[model samples]
Target: MKDFSAEITYKTSRSSGAGGQNVNKVETAVTAIWNVMESAVFRFDEKLRISEKLKNRINSEGLLQMTASESRTQVQNKKIVTEKMLDLVEKALFVPKKRLATKPSKGQIQKRIDNKKKLSEKKENRKFRF
Candidate 1:
């Protein structure tokens, strides 16, 4: 979605999950790597935003990595990994709307106080007399 295809690199290895002998013979696992620091797809602010939001995923060398091995074919695995990587980057780039702090309205506050008073009155009425 962000035109990161040019900046991504892929590595393949034997898939570990399933496929028995086929797994041993073929390299279906795909690892997608992107160098965030050297990426031309994002501006400086966006780069910083991604780095900050995805700090755990990005290594010291500024490489963002994702792996996919569920598919039996290398091409399918590559596609899955690429999609995952794009989703990760897109999520990291998103900025949430800031929240504005405000006090409760006078009527709301009064309603809360009234509820508390009613509860207290009920509790007091439940007390046993000597």
Candidate 2:
């Protein structure tokens, strides 16, 4: 996997949770900001695809943003945000292959019809009327 770390910009702020006094004093939370329009890593079409696919995550300024504060330490949180940003971009650019149309073979269709007839006959016979 190509590391797109060069394309990202990180900001730090004081985060909440799990650290003693450090939580209030130190900036542990990491926010990764990547400008989709400015990134040279991807082509124009791929950038468009990423923008459209991740519209909710992208801001008005066209920067894709992700934040990580789950960890108590700055390094760990930075790792989390970077990985998350990469993963989100990877998923956004993904396009699934189109499936070909298929039909049941003649024998399989006949067998299905035969089974339906058998079921219908069995149910009809179960109606025990004089």
Q: What TM-score does each of the candidates earn? A: 0.92, 0.94
TM-score of 1: 0.92
Worst 10 residues of 2 by lDDT: 1-10
Query: Residue 59 of candidate 2: its Cα lDDT?
Result: 93
Residue 58 displacement (Å), model 1: 1.6
Full-model lDDT, candidate 1: 0.91
- Residues 27-70, model 2: lDDT tens digits: 99999999999988888999899999999989999998889999
What's the lDDT for candidate 2?
Answer: 0.91
The sequence of per-residue lDDT tens digits that candidate 1 reaches over residues 1-130 is 5878778999999889778899889989999999998999899999999999999989999999888998999999899998888888898888899999999999999999999999999999999999
Cα lDDT computed for each candidate against the true fold:
0.91, 0.91
Candidate 1: misplaced stretches above 4 Å? none
